[model samples]
Target chain A: MASLIDLANPTRFMRLSAVLLPWLAAAAAVLLVVGFYLAWFSAPPDYQQGETVRILYVHVPAAWLAMMFYSMMALSALGTLVWRHPLADVAQKAAAPIGACFALICLVTGALWGKPMWGTYWVWDARLTSMLVLLLIYLGIIALWRVLDEPSRAGRAVAILTLIGFVNVPIIKFSVDWWNTLHQPASVFRMGGSTLDPSMLWPLLILAAGFTLFALALHMVSMRAEIMRRRVRTLTILEAERLDRLAAQGAPA
Target chain B: MNDLIAPLGPHADYILGSYAAVAVVLVGLAASILRDHAAQKKALAALEERGAGRRSGRRAS
Candidate 1:
């Protein structure tokens, strides 16, 4: 916990991230390349889905990250409410847009996949509907932050909303199982065992890892940028106040 | 996508489109992050310099 606080300190974070940035960026690039290669070439085509199944390389990972991002936001939200870490607000605010982007990718790719598989571009199946609601939650967070000028207040408000919206996450997960849905049930991560064939599993796993790392790299960069933005805003405000005082002193003295 | 793309054989517009979209968004996002960082750094530097100038003038008096 102490280590985490030290890491979260803005100056420490900036220094640490500066040292680690190149490594993370390189790892993201290398993993993405290998993952894409396997996904495109090495992985066998699905007997049922064929090449369209290749879209899973991108779709599944994005879908996973979409959920992961929301969970992260919830945790950051909690951090904001409980610890009130200065970095938490920056993290929470920085995460919103990226989470929304991942959600959008998930939705768009799901639609594209659905069109060929289910003969429809859109469906209100419980799984799809819940995911849509999740996307909306992300958007609402972004919108809330945008509307509120006060960062801490916005963080508090978002934290409450995120905690409430977290109830939808499990619903999103179980929706397909609970209903006669077009979407498939859990295949990759399951209690008994993964149903995926070895030929396909390796590529998917690599892609998933690549996506996770990529998200982390992006999040760190974004958090750093947000912290800097706040610092600059503070400096600007203080400068303006100082100028105001100087102008007053000079007036008809 | 494998279903639709495999049939297209040598030409798969949908597969191509998906890749294009992903590349564009990722690059755009990277660029935006870099630009924001640069702008913030500049603003911070300027503020620090101005603050230093004010301090020096205060010492002068």
Candidate 2:
């Protein structure tokens, strides 16, 4: 059992990811196939929403992943600030674009689901608005990563931004319940278990699992790329220093 | 099979549109990530090769 600290080393992390990425991609593919079948062909249509309910299969999972990636970033932020884990900021940086994509998917799909159900696509509902804010925060963190050249400095900045932005996570979760909104309240995850029938609940859960695995695979690949990028940067600097030394000695650089 | 599933009726366009949007976005993101990974790996390998060749030449000299 490799500890988190052990995996902080880039070489170790890359080696572990090489073994894990293929399995994750395979599992994600299989789950998505089965889950989509269940969601599309096996499940019964909702009494009210009908075929439009199929949108839930993808939308809910995207929304969940959007929030999940943010939460993961928050944890990575702690790792960067407190533990000073070398890979923490790398993980954080890689996760941002993926999370942002998911957030965009969630918002767009929710709007699509809303148009017919609510008679209009645009609304200023609490859940919708707060979720939009979450997407913006994810984008902001990504922008911050690009603007700062120094990884250590960017890491600190992003970590603080992520922590501060975390205040919106709970707000997004509770916005539906705390305020009267067009968005539906908790049906699947509630105190007394899901109100959804097992027929529907099972497929949604499977779809969510597939989406989670897919996101994990993407994050792992992105992190590996980030590590390689840093290695290239280091090697470039070393070569530049060598050239500078040779020039100082009046040797052909 | 198609009849059993029942068409989305008036909302068919919206529902299908949503799924299409998701597939497009996810595919695009995956492609972008893979492209970056390949480019970075190529860069790292090239840098290492150059550095190694230089070190060997210096040793021979």
Candidate 3:
């Protein structure tokens, strides 16, 4: 087995990702198709939400992934600030936009689910509001990365921002329980066992797994792109410096 | 086909819209990531071919 430190090397990571990318993408695609089929056909409608319950298939998974990606980023932030892992800050930067997209999807789908069930498209409920905040944080992190031109400077800034912003992750998770919100309480992850039937639960879990794989595959690709982009910058700068040295040597002393 | 997959009933529009939204966002995200990856790969390969840097074909250890 490859050592963790060895895998952290950019060349090693690139080679590994090159081999793993196709398999990961293929698995994600297959899992998503199977999960969607089960969700649409196999799972029965809820007694209360009726056909609207179908929204849960996408909504739940998107929400879960949004939070999961943030947690991943938070850990990456630690690696950036603490260990100064070469890939850590790169991974965090690469993942922000994807996390933001997931959060946006969660918000939009949740609203779509909300309108039919709750009779309104928007609400200030704890779950909904905190989730919106989470989306904003993702956008903020992405913007921070863009505004700072220096990777080293941006890495530290983003690390600090990510760690500070992580307070909202737990808020998003516990908002429903902490407040008398319109959103339903935890049913699938509670200690008393899931209230959801096996039929519904299986599809939800499968879809969640598919989304996790999809996000990871995208992250891997994004990290590769970031690494290549950095390499290009370094090469361009080095070429310019070499030309300057040759010109200086040819000039009269 | 609608009958076979359990009719979405009165809330069909919402359900379909929710799924559509997810599909669009995820597909768009995937496309953007893949496009960036391709562009970066091409740029890096071009630079390496030009021998622009002494560090080409080797990691900065």
Candidate 4:
């Protein structure tokens, strides 16, 4: 088993991810299928919301993933700035769009769920607004990557931005508790214990796990592609330098 | 199909629409990543084929 430090090397990470991704993808697919089946057929509808409650299966997972990925990026940002881990910036860059997509899914699904239950598609509540802010922060980090042009420079700048944006995470989590919001407070992970019934909770848990594994698989592949892209950039620069030398020598004239 | 959806009540569209949207976003995300991976791999292979080797003398493959 390679140590964590050893896996930080891009080549090693690529080799390990290639071996693990297929198995990870297969397991995620299985779990998702089972979870969806149970959610649709086995779980009872909410007494108040009825069938609209079914949306919770997908909505909760997307919302969890959206926050989870941002937290991971914040850690990766720390690795880039503090430890200067080689693969840290690559991981952060690759995760941005993915996190943004999950956030978008969360918002859209929450709206769909909200309409039938809350009588409206949206509210300017703290939780929803903070979640939207998180998504915007992700988009900003992604744009920063493109604008910088140089990888190392972009990495440092985005790392700072990511750490600053992390302040919103706690606010998003505690927003409902601190304020009278339309969104419900934490049910599954409260300090007193989960208030959710086991029947519904099981499906939600399984689906969350499945989505997490799927996102990790996607992240790994994206990182591998980023590594290859950097390699291409290096080789192109080397090729250009060689042409410059050849021109200086006037050998090909 | 009707039998399956009938149990969802009058707001079946909302429920079904949520799931459908999730499916679309996830599928789109996966496709984009895979396409990017392929493109990068192809570019690296092409560059190496042109004798533009890495400074460390390591090939990506």
lDDT of each: 0.80, 0.90, 0.89, 0.92
lDDT score for candidate 1 against the true structure: 0.80
User: What TM-score would chain B receive for each of the candidates shown?
Assistant: 0.66, 0.73, 0.78, 0.82
Q: Candidate 3, A200: how far from true, in Å?
A: 0.5
* Residue A6 lDDT in candidate 2: 77
Q: How accurate is candidate 3 locally (lDDT)?
A: 0.89
Those runs of model 4 whose alpha carbons end farther than 4 Å from true positions after fitting are A1-3, B54-61
lDDT of 4 by residue, A149-238 (tens): 889889999999999999999999999899999999999999989988999999999999999999999999999999999999988899
Candidate 2 chain A: 10-residue stretch with minimal lDDT: A1-10
Worst 10 residues of 1 chain A by lDDT: A244-253
Error of 1 at A174 (Å): 1.8
In the range A122-146, model 3's lDDT, one tens digit per residue, is 9999999999999999999999999
In candidate 4 the C-alpha lDDT for residue A199 amounts to 98
Given candidate 2, what's the lDDT at residue A82?
90
TM-score for chain B in model 1: 0.66
Off by over 4 Å in 3: A1-3, A250-253, B1-6, B55-61
Which 10 successive residues of model 4 chain A have the least lDDT summed? A1-10
Residue pairs of candidate 4 with colliding backbone atoms: none
Q: Candidate 4: what lDDT?
A: 0.92
**Model 1 TM-score relative to the real fold:** 0.91
Give all candidate RMSDs, comma-separated: 3.3, 2.5, 3.4, 2.4
TM-score of chain A of each: 0.96, 0.97, 0.96, 0.97
What is the DockQ score of candidate 2, to 2 decimals? 0.64
By DockQ, the candidates rank as 4, 2, 3, 1
